[model samples]
Target: MEKNQSLVEENEKLSRGLSEAAGQTAQMLERIILTEQANEKMNAKLEELRKHAACKVDLQKLVETLEDQELKENVEVIRNLQQVITQLSDETVACMAAAIDTAVEPEAQVEISPGSSRSSDAFTTQHALRQAQMSKELVELNKALALKEALAKKMTQNDSQLQPIEFQYQDNIKNLELEVINLQKEKEELVLELQTTKKDVNQAKLSERRRKRLQELEGQIADLKKKLNEQSKLLKLKESTEHTVSKLNQEIRVMKNQRVQLMRQMKEDAERFRQWKQQKDKEVIQLKERDRKRQYELLKLERSFQKQSNVLRRKTEEAAAANKRLKDALQKQREVTEKRKETQSRGMEGTTARVKSWLGNEIEVMVSTEEAKRHLNDLLEDRKILAQDVAQLKEKVESGENPPPKLRRRTFSLAELRGQVSESEDSITKQIESLETEMELRSAQIADLQQKLLDAESEDRPKHRWENIATILEAKCALKYLIGELVSSKIQVSKLESSLKQNKASCADMQKMLFEERNHFAEIETELQAELVRVEQQHQEKVLYLLSQLQQSQMAEKQLEESVSEKEQQLLSILKCQDEELEKMQEVCEQNQQLLRENKIMKQKLNLLQVASRQKSHLPKDTLLSPDSSFEYIPPKPKPSRFKEKFLEQSMDIEDIKYCSEYSVNEPEDSDGDGGDGDDEEWKPTKLVKVSKKNIQ
Candidate 1:
């Protein structure tokens, strides 16, 4: 490179001398020509030409002195430039060698670090400065590098050695032109391939669009199916509610019928009690009337006998008193019978049987007192045994020695079910918080993207101008028909620039949207986390409640089992006692009926005795009075009757049936209702009562 610069310097000096010498020689020749012909025509200009020739020769000699300091500084500046050029040339050679080595070595060895890139940038700057200087030198060399001056110098120094580089440069230029041609052909081939790839992409887009349409249809179908399922579930629940209502109504109707039957039984019992009382009054009255009539007849017979024995007055004085007693008894009998009739008119017949029948069921219910005591004793003994066992069980359970809870392993274990919901809620809450943070980040990203888009738009507006101008120049040059191919190249370049600008814009927009979306997702996650936390808290609360309920349920189950056991024992005892009492009641009722029959037979005998007594009373003395006469007229008053008793028995039997039906039907039903879900079950007493009353009424 230094040699090139020196050669350039030497050539500049030679050109200056040659220019001076030529000027001097031209002036000298002009002077000679003037002296030869135009002496008479160039009278004043002739001397001036001679003077110009003399000055030109002096300038020529001065131009030849190239070894001066001014020239040396110029040389030194050139030398510095030469050194820079030499350094640059050597670096280029080194870079080339390195590149060759990089290609030969593996890919791992030739990495460009940031620092290396910076160094290369500095090198590029130095190269750029040298290139500018070189460009100026090329212009100077082309104008001043004269072969004629070298020829003249060769003539002066006949024995000097010299070689020029002109032929070598001409050969280099031809080779460069050939390389450019090959590169252009390759670029054309690449353009053709790019066009083919674009066609393939267009075809793929059509297929993808078809696939997306199919996916949309499937999604719509799934959504419709889900809606149908929801509707079906709703319909099922509605039907169940209707069924429940119908069952409730039926139960209420049955209860109403039982209530009516009980009321009728109570009315019948009251009627029977009244009738028994009336019958008892009537029977007592009839017995008293019969007794009185019999007493009167006895008195009459005694009086008749006394009359017959009047002749023998001293024989029976006591018979006269007896006759008076019988007459008094006859009057009392009539009074008693009338009183009995009046009492019968007010009250009804015999009611003892009715009262007994109704109360028989009540009293016959003998509590199983002995059995209860026995069972209680057994239970107490068992409790004592259980207490001892409990201590041992407690010890085992304390050390986790009890059998595991009666549960199988499930995704939702009772323990995990108790707490997993809360954990998930907490996790979700944390996620929500993270999402919130992400949302903020997305907002920042969106702002950044927006800024990037603005920047891109600003840069693009001016960039297109350069491309457009280049296109116009190219188009003007080509459309002139001088070079149509050049216009296409220019158009391709312009299109590439537009596409790059559009891609940059799209990239900036996409980046902004993606960043915003990411942040939004973060916010959503944070919100979800918060929701999860809330859900977890709710779940924890529910778990705690459920655990308490489970504990309560366990305790209740224990109580229920104990109660059920007790109930079973009591029920068996009570059933046995009730059966015994029922048998005893039936015996007592049969005995009472037999006694009523006896009373009727006794009344018939009393009636026969009354007729005989009336015969004696017919012959009674004028004024007979005694304490025995009062006793004779006493009659049975109206009172209870067997017919009333029978009616009462029938009523009681009906009432027992009613009571059993009402209790039996209601007990199990109420228990089931109690076991129903607490949320949905409702005993609509008002509705039921109204319906029941309506049916009963």
Candidate 2:
């Protein structure tokens, strides 16, 4: 007390309420950290949902394989035609060799003329044999020419049909690659956030460890202070007692002087001595009691302090473990983000390769667009030439003139052979329709599968059950593969339809050509009027039957037309519903992204608190942010211990920023301020979408 008499009043003036509020705030901050973690988890889920909504599946390989199958089928037909040609060629060659050998030896045939008449017969027979061989060779050449022509037609049909679908497939693959890249970027961002979180957690653990150690050291210092206070009190009490005793002696001396005057000198001396003895005894007892009470109080205080220290140690351990776990999680997140980015890049590359392959390599099935147009022009020119030739023949016939022998001898109906192009149009139409339907159904089913997965997770089902469901979904994808055959068949049908339309036009040209040819044939047969008349009747009957079949097909098309119109209306309704759902999904994704950003910021703030633990002096207002906070939102706080700050900041700069997700809705609904549902009307749900862009920190 004597050594520091001026400090007592200053120490007594600070109230208890302010200390309590500081403690409550510390606890509040801890809860905030926990909340931020929850927000991070929520944000991740939201991001996943957003990705699922926007994600597109790739099917390029399947499409290419389908085209290959078509090529194979077309090649099969060509192969059959080639085989027929080969057979005819072999027969012709065999027949030719026999005729040539026989014709070369007419002398031998004459030697057998003793049977001279028989020899003449043999020579005549050899001539017949040679003539038969020539006829066979002619037939073989005609068949080979027909097969070549048919192959050319098939190639043209396939090239036209698969070209559009291949282009569309390639485009879709490119879009998917872009989406994958975006998703990967998002994942990388998340991972970086996680890494920052891990650093914060580690810092938190170190700070907590330091805090516990400091608390222990403070407790020990307080114990020492208590001992020092007790000793000082004892020293002061002893000094005061001595001072009082000295004063009492002086008073006794004064009393002795007075008593000597009042009583006898001997009585005064005895009374003073007895009183002094009794005072000494009383002082000794008081000192002993004081020491005992101080000792008891110190023992009780140490016990209470020790219990608190133990509790603090346990808490410190728990906090350290939690911090480590959080740091680990953050590290994992960072790694995952990096991996996601890498995966995205790889996927993009793969997609590009696939698109290029589909478009570039499948040449046998489809030619380039330019080539198709050119081929079309060529076909038109060919048809024109055929028509002109037919017209001239018809004119000659109409003039009642006999046709030249050359024209009659080399009769080849190229127009009749090319009418098969109509089949290609039918196949191409069916292919496109089926492919579109399959794509739509697959997309919808994927959505449904994702929804079911969400429901299962929300219901807290076990992993095994979800796995079973996943298996079922996989089986369905397999089922789609099995349906590939049907899809391919539809593709063929579409191609056939396209071919049918083109061939129909050709057929019309062929019909005109046929009429001209018929006229020419009629001229050739002018010497045999009955024969010409019979052939004409037969041809007319066949044409009439074909026309009847065509009329019936038209009637069938009309009936199907009404049903298709209704289905198209239904498809429109479904599209609108999908748009609404996508809108909601988009909103959720934005919220998740926002929440993640907020979590990262707050985690940095928690880390700042750790750095603040070792601080011994106040920090500047601007330099206290952690890395997670965006540049503008960091708040400044006074530093407590400079040593802590110095050691923590040695390896890494502490930005000391804090993030709070307290913003409002940022929904992409009616950015024009209204959903365009009304004009000059009070804002309502119908007219305006209340997009609450909440900060989901």
Candidate 3:
């Protein structure tokens, strides 16, 4: 009972274990299904992203747009500022012209009054000539003042015309700035969203079903890994690719550094250009003021000449007798005036030439810088492309898309990548050093130019000031052009930076994808391993159960054989006992047959003796029928057979035979009365017959 109870308990436990295993398997399957669904969804999302990649709001494009817009606004502002500066210059020129006219008028009037007083005593041809010259000078002065007033009025009109345009441009700039800010905010928000998505993806948990599928997936993973590893040629290809990529990366880094240096140089150039522009603007303003002063001084000189002519006319009338002397003096004065004009013209020409030469040099410098910047930009673009290619190669390496066949190959690839990266870094360092040297040289050149400008300013002659003013105006125009170029360069730099940022984002995205793929592969491998373990465990259990069942069957068969053999042995023993009993009954039957034969013989002899006695009894009754009849019967009877003596005489003589026969018949009936052990009692008649025979003997 205890054993039965124990078996029942074991069966219940086994059933529970089986149920638990089945449940676990079911859960595992469910998890696997869920994971598969998730994988499908992820694949769909990837597809969607691919499809929309172009359509998406590219940050680089937006940044470029903003930069372009800003550059445009800056250019407009610079243009407006230039216009204002020109207008101011014009106004100053007009004011100087008016001042010159005023100063000349007063001097001419004072001199004419003195000449008129001297000529009061005489009205000669000399007086008339003096009056005519004075009138012509007055008219010229008045015309100059009128022209100056008209020019000032035109400048004012131009200023009024520019005011509204400038205001409108300012408003437009403000609106563009606001839009740029909004776009920047949007870009930041998008970046935050991207980060959140990445975090969520990272935080996602593995499902139970996926865990269960791990083992089943192992074989597939092995096959895939095997295929990935089988390409020996690919390993060499990968190595070469890595080398190329490394070389490219190094070249790219060198180029990038060069580009950076170029950009820095451009920035320095732009700053210097701005400074030069400011200095030139200041110089232009100073020159304009000086030119005005020079104009006023020239007007004063003209007035003095006009006054001298009036005084000479008065003296000529008074000293008509000394007309020849007066003529000689006038000739000398004319000669002196001619010499002074010639010298002034020469000075103006020389100063103008110098200023033009300076401007040409500055323009040449600007053009050279622009060309260098363009060359650097082109190099930067080339470097950017190379960097992109290198990044692609790195991504391919990291992605393990065509993984190396073995650990050694993988290591080789890794080493190659590292080597390439190191080489590139070294190259970049060298390039940077070279660029730094170049930048220093350029800086020195700029300093020299600045020093030259300072020297020119310090050594400038007073007479050449007007010439300098004209040169300053030309320089201001150059500065405006340079400012525009600077703005353009700045825009280009911003575009490059934006491109770089975009490339970085793309590279980061690719890295993320590679990492995800790697993680997925690892997860799959783990799942496959787990599934394999579970399957192996299940197989082992099944094998154990089958083995146990086989053992149980063998044991049952052995027990059955044992029980069958025991039964057979028992049957044989029963058969032998029955055979022994049957033989004893046969012996009793033979004895009974013998007793029957003896009884038959005794009956025949008794019949014969009875007949003889009956016949003799009629004639010799007195002779034979005496008291000794028993002796006469004994003499007549043949000696009873041994069978009769034993069988009949043991129990009965003639009477004993009858009694024994009757007793034998009665014994058989008595033996038949009880049925228990009846077969054993069935031979009792033979035993009784034997006993009766012994008693008869």
Candidate 4:
């Protein structure tokens, strides 16, 4: 039983050892994985460092190709120092990694044997030492990386500083190149000037008169230059004023066009008024002609009526004379009859039959006389009615109303009335001749009857006497009635003659008035013609004056243009002279730079030789010249003063020209103050003139 218990305890001890060995091996494998991860991280860091080292080498090569010798040498020194530092850091890191690998390989081999605890303890201690060494190496590598980063920062700072210096150097080189080109131009100009001087010297030596002439020409040239400057100033002022002047011209043209339109309108209105007046006058003349013709027709009618009344009056006078004669004869017969009756009373019974026959004859005579009296009365009534009609017609004609239809029909032209009056006179004459023939026959019968009655009275005087006495009384009554009608007709004729005289007077007055009106119209026409002629003359004069003024203004504008052109030419010449002066200045700057370079070179050489002599101790100090004595300071020539004087003169001339222009522009306004009346009253010219004056000022 004791042998079996001892065997069980040995088996328990073997199992415990195996479990411990397995746990230790698992721990070692975990540590190895951790170490491999650390190694991969270190390798990535080294590759980054190698890439940075390669960029630094490229920078060194770029710096070696620099144009500046001093900067290139400095960059080379910094680049070599950085490369040596990087190589030392890389070698140290590689050695540390190799020692860590050698130490870890033995720790891994010893860990595989699970029976030896002392060997495992020794492996742990060695691994600890290797980890400590690796830690120290990592610290050193980190310090080296920090140093490299600081160097890169310093190098970048240096490169940043040098970039601006290089840009400045390039700028200075370009400036020098430009200066050299300008210097060449100046050299050419100087050669031309020298040639000209030589010519002038030769001409001066040839004749004293020529030298005096050259001086005179120089003085003239100076004067011309002054004039040119003044002209240029004036041209500038003129250019500024041209816009205003052109605007004024446009306004003037517009105003002139308006004026022309207004004049045309006025002329049209005048012509229309004249035509209307002429038309009205023609109408008035036509009316007057119509009135004159009417009056003439009325006068003709009156004349015809007067002629008819005169003929009627003559007929009445003739009738009255015949009646008077008949009455006288009748009275004589009645006396004779009474005497016969007295003689017959003594023998009353002797002749009774003879007295009855005589009474019958006397009764026939009384009936004839009564019939003639009735005819005369009818004629008188006709004359009275005709007279009344004539009076009414005269009244209507005088009152200027239309005549009655009867009068209108009776009215005739002058020629027709004259012919009618002649025809009526001829008819009246024929009637009077017939009446006289009948009266002669009746008178003869009366004579024969008187003879018969004397014979019968002797036989029976008492019987016939009473009947003859009664017949004589009746005849006397008839004769008295005819005489009254004749007197009335004579009075009416006289009234008609008076009215005709008054009508004649009125016609004469009307004719005189017509003549006077014609004279007045003629006088008015003459006056209108005279006024029209005068107005036309005034308009012509005004137009001519305006044309002349326009011509003068145009001429002035042409002169201004010519002056402007001349000024422009002078300005071009002045600009060319300024360019030449700029070239001369550039040449002077180039000379200054060359002299400074020579002085610096001489100083450097003197310092070097002095240092060499001191080292050799053989060369004498007296042989080399002193720095200050070797280089003589020669000052550059001063710039010409004429250009500055010309600039100042040009400025002064511009001011003077401005003042002159102002004065000239204002002068016209002062002069124009007087002629404000007459045609100058036109608004366009005055306003334009004023505007021009204001703009110029």
TM-score of each: 0.13, 0.13, 0.25, 0.24
Worst 10 residues of 2 by lDDT: 657-666
TM-score of model 3 relative to the true fold? Answer: 0.25
lDDT tens readout by residue for model 4, 1-697: 6886456445434433433443343344335435645854775575467557553566566695798988888777777766766786678566655544454343433333333233222333333333333333333333343343334434444555565755665565556556555655555554455446544656546545544544565565556555555555654554454554455456545543553454344345435544755665676566445546655654676686566556655555544554544454455456545655665543333233234334433443454355345435545454455555545545554564532121222223334334544553454344345445444543444444444334433545446545543444434543444466468779999899999889999988999999999999999999999999999999999999999999999988998988898898899889889989888676645544443454345446544544443343333435333454332343432233432343234333344334434543443344335433341222111111111222121
Every model: Cα RMSD to truth: 87.7, 73.0, 57.2, 59.1
Model 4 RMSD, rounded to 1 decimal = 59.1
How big is the positional error of residue 695 in model 2, measured in Å on the Cα after superposition?
A: 14
Off by over 4 Å in 2: 1-564, 576-580, 583-587, 590-594, 610-614, 617-697
Q: Give the CA lDDT, 0 to 100, for residue 394 in model 4.
A: 51
- Can you give the lDDT of residue 646 in candidate 4? 35
Clashes of each: 49, 53, 16, 0
lDDT of 1 by residue, 18-111 (tens): 3333333333333533452453244235334433434234333344566686875655564455455446545644553453343323212212
Report lDDT per candidate: 0.43, 0.43, 0.49, 0.49
**Consecutive 10-residue window with the lowest summed lDDT within model 4:** 682-691
lDDT of 2 by residue, 1-697 (tens): 7544334323222211222222233233335435535744754564454345222322343344555777767655655554555565456445534533443232332222122111122323333333333333323332332343334334443544545754564565555456555545555554454445434777668656655655565565556555555555655655565565555556545543443342232234334433654564565456445435644644563465455445444544443343344344434434543554455445444434333332222221122222333333433343344345345435544563321111221111233212322332343334335434433543443344334334323443333322321234334543454476469879999999999999999999999999999999888778478776887888888888888888878877876786787788789889888988898677656656654555465446544543442241134435544464234442342233432343243322233211121111122123224334342132112111112334321
